[model samples]
Target: MAESHIDLGVVTAPSGVLVLGMASWIDHWPQLGGTLSERARASASIGGGHVHDWMCEMVAVRAAGDRPLTVRAGTAKSPLDGGPTIATLEIDLGIPWVRTAGNEPIILGDLPVDRCGMVLGDALALDSWTGDGHPSTDGLADVTYWGAHAEAAHRQFGGELIPGRGNQVRGWLDLPLDDAKSLGDALGDWTGDEQGRGVMVAVDEHNDFHSFNRASRTHPLLIGAIEVADCPVLGINWDSGDHSMRHRGERPFGQVYPVTLQPDRTGRTTMRWTIPPYAPGHDGPE
Candidate 1:
């Protein structure tokens, strides 16, 4: 018997969905050269913000209907990280995909969705880009959505079983960075000590979700790692500096593509999914 895989799913235009781990601001660490309050202030002004790849387990969706579904989630926060890691969150599905289950599962929804996947958790988007802060190569805040926060780019598409098991949640969102130069400047001396560090959000054709490193607009997806002990709050701690997924000498995951975002004079930015439509390309037996 072969493992089952499904199409991840997509979010059209401004609205989107994500089953992300806890996310947080990148510059919240002093070793990384910034403070939580400083990053918070910058996040309030600049468009460039970074967050930890994705850690905990969270679902974020943006759509019509304003309501919070009651749930008994984890209230305990990570000793290392400040935010609550395990919690029952009210997941308001803007687009309900399946029927509720019998037992109260950690995640609720129909079982074994043949062609579609289940959506859990509510949507949380924090829009605070004033576009008034000065743009720098380094020291910029990352975008935050829902209570989970934000992550950046990289792309993948396919329609086969993702080679893993169990239910997987996936979705997409857009973010603005400090261009390649500013990003490069922030990287400074890349001795793996303090190289280009950031967070990103991505979903593949298999509906496999990923919150990986946010590479520079100019840097290649080279393999690297950073010590992430000081910043324990999963929501604000952006860089885990963990590259264990890739083997030694292995290239960074996912195919790097150019994302064209249009920012009107008003400073509001918009990006549409192009090649390989934003939705998952699931080609499994239906």
Candidate 2:
């Protein structure tokens, strides 16, 4: 086992939510034991590589707002290295936003009581695992550590975890190049009073939509949406196999409306958009 670390840079968002990207490059894939080996064997049997190990992308700490919130990632057992893969909201040290990656991205932190985030495109990358090898034990070991950390954080900052919403919709939007670009630009601009109604849309290399979510602050904010666009069409390809939820199955020419972030009388910001329905040939999720 080897130890390594990479500084993922800093965040400084006043909105109290941050989205960070995690990427990994394994120098060598290690042989393993326990459940990791079993999973690795299964993956290899079906032409999979490095599907059982987890990667830590960004660690968030609650400290002074003026203090730089430096994000970093490291491997405890394997010699791995990666950097923050995307640009996102600055961290408002007042709130904690940490994320870990396995096959899918998992967010951990506290969010404003009234704010919500959404996920679009494939919210979870069930088959795309980063890193070179399997862990020595069942993946639960990492979970145990994270669980304890969560408990400690809870005790320090009292809050109960609440379940957010999840929905699976099957359809795609075919926007003109300009509209597509505008949508893409709006997705990156996080400045505004809109405290809630943040949407994370995931797409493929071909700019085909695959996942969508109205997520909570507890989940990674919105950076993942941009990263997913660069990914291969994992939802429909063999890489995802039968595990991916077919969220975006139809491609229809759709109009893109301007995304508006308006502040209400109470000074709270909210994002508003009227997403068009699937084209005539396609239907939304039942």
Clashes of each: 28, 26
- Residues 183-279 of candidate 1: C-alpha lDDT, one tens digit per residue: 3333222222144443322222110111122221111211111112211011111112211111111112231112222322343232211112112
State the lDDT at 197 in candidate 2.
33
User: Can you write out model 2's per-residue Cα lDDT over 116-189, one digit (the tens) per residue?
Assistant: 11221111221233322333111211100113133433343322333222122211234344544444444334
User: Whose TM-score is greatest here?
Assistant: 1
Per-candidate Cα lDDT values, in order, are 0.23, 0.25
The parts of candidate 1 lying over 4 Å away from their true place are 1-73, 79-84, 94-286
